[model samples]
Target: MTNLLRSIRTLPLLAFLIAIPALAAPTIIELSSEASRPAINDLVRATVSAEATGTTLGELSKQVNSLIAEALKTAKAFPRVKTQSGNTSTYPIYSKGGKIESWRIRSELSLESGDTAALSELLGKLQSSLGVSNLVLQPSPETRKKAENEAMLDAIAAFKARAKVIADAFGKPYRIKQLSVNTSGNVVQPLFRATAKAMMADAAPMPMEAGESQISATVSGQIELE
Candidate 1:
């Protein structure tokens, strides 16, 4: 029992000794580097919605559904455009007396295409029966991936250059103790919107411009100087 007690007393000292070497190690410096490139937005996405209000929920739903269905069928005529159903929502409208006077139903249709002209023309057709809710132009997956990879390579090079400069400034040899890389991007959304009156006036092709997005990559790391 006396021997065991002595060993337990030494446990704290042993741990302190074990941590001494790590605490006395060389200085660790942290640095980060980034690179970015503009990628062309080759894809277009548009959201169109149909909404109806009626005293009967079933009637409102039917009206909204019929318009969405017609929009989908019309979208089929554009071979380059792909169509999909988006959100479907039903909510009750309240009157001044705080009572449910009518129900409103709304449904959305999402369209995407690489051919901007075809998509623009399709939007014009869709706007005749449905309201344009949102429109976005962005880089395609392949394009974004390529841009990110290129940026990552450049960022890595920049990080290494910075590390070398730091080591030289300190007059020490260094090794990477920890490293991490990340990539980010933002989607390009245009300011143009189609109004109900414009859509009803004539079946004219909507003007569209596919913008560019900046894709960036960052490399961060800690270096241990010896």
Candidate 2:
């Protein structure tokens, strides 16, 4: 009976010993690092829209379809350009007394190309029947990917440099406990409203200036000191 009581008394001490590592304090430091580079915009994207209104939805739909079909035919003539049909929306127009006066239907065509000259020429042709709704110049996917890879390398280097500085300041050796890296990029958006309006009045080729895009990468995580 005395031995059984002694064993029961030692149970709480044994449990405390097993939990010692879990109770230990964590020593970690959080840090962030980033890198960025410039990439030239090599792709052009444009959105052309055709809108029509009629007394009946059927008439409006027919008109819009004809306009889109013509645009698609013209776009297909250029083998290097990429074209896709976009959104089609139809809505009722209300009169002064809230009565339905007409139905308006709008359809969009999206165009993309690395050859700016060809895209410009196509845009000029389509503008006769469609209005320029949106235009953007950006880096191509391949270019963006290359830039991101480069930036990632730079960011990782910067992160290690910073981590070393931190370890030196802390006067201890450290190990990476956790880490994460991210990439981002920016595209230059030039005003195109005036340009589009000017193109509508003239048949001359659209003037294009592809600016630069900024690609960036960031590294963030925690390090534990030993």
Candidate 3:
């Protein structure tokens, strides 16, 4: 009986030792994946602001208001044309102090549409009337999603390629352990800032070219090494 018990205990110990090599194998390497794409739609937001000076707060206010109203009246068909009036106060126009400029009101307009051509035409029209203060273009949601997915797929492919290379280099087969990633997309907006607040201007319409804006997304993650 003593011998039999000793053999049983030794057998368990032997099995545990034999299992160690299979349980804690050192044959796998770590791999990672990352992807990124441009957020196109999210960034395509454009704000057109018009700036002008008035002799007094009331006078500037009236002019800015009038111009915005007139622009809207003409652009009845244009979509996403939103206008807002901003604060008015004395501001130095050209570093000339004590200009005692009466009122400095601003009219802001924003447009969000996929039709870049129409938007450009509308922007040109707006500039022709209201003097331009600033113009900003940003991406939209649709663009962002598309770009992000494309980037992610590319990144995953890249990671797989790299893993293949590593596995081949090691001269043995490997399996994936774990994979994870983090990603971020930035908004890249083009800014057209005018010295004066944008308003219906006297000069020729400012030509706007809303060209293809590159949106970018970046993804980073690790894959379990096998």
Q: Judged by TM-score, which candidate is best?
A: 1
Tens digits of per-residue lDDT for model 2, 1-226: 9999999999999999999987776679999899988888999998988888889888888888998999899888888899998999998999999999998888888999999889989988887778887889999999999999999999989988988999999898888999999999887666765322333665556778888899999999998877
The pairs that clash in candidate 1 are none
Residue-by-residue lDDT tens digits, candidate 3, 11-104: 9899999999898776655556665544433223455555667566677767767776777775566765444444433464443674554556
> How far does residue 80 in candidate 3 sit from its true spot (Å)?
6.8
* Candidate 1: worst-modelled 10 consecutive residues by lDDT: 192-201
Write model 1 residue lDDT over 74-140, tens digit each, in one string. Answer: 8889989999899999899999999999988888889999999999998877777788879999999
Q: Candidate order by TM-score, highest to lowest? A: 1, 2, 3
**lDDT values, one for every candidate:** 0.89, 0.86, 0.58
Better of 1 and 3 by TM-score: 1
TM-score of each: 0.85, 0.82, 0.63
Q: Judged by lDDT against the true structure, how good is candidate 3?
A: 0.58
Cα error, residue 152 of model 1, in Å, equals: 0.5
RMSD values, in order shown: 5.8, 4.2, 5.7
Model 2: which ten-residue window has the lowest total lDDT?
Answer: 193-202
Candidate 3 TM-score, C-alpha based: 0.63
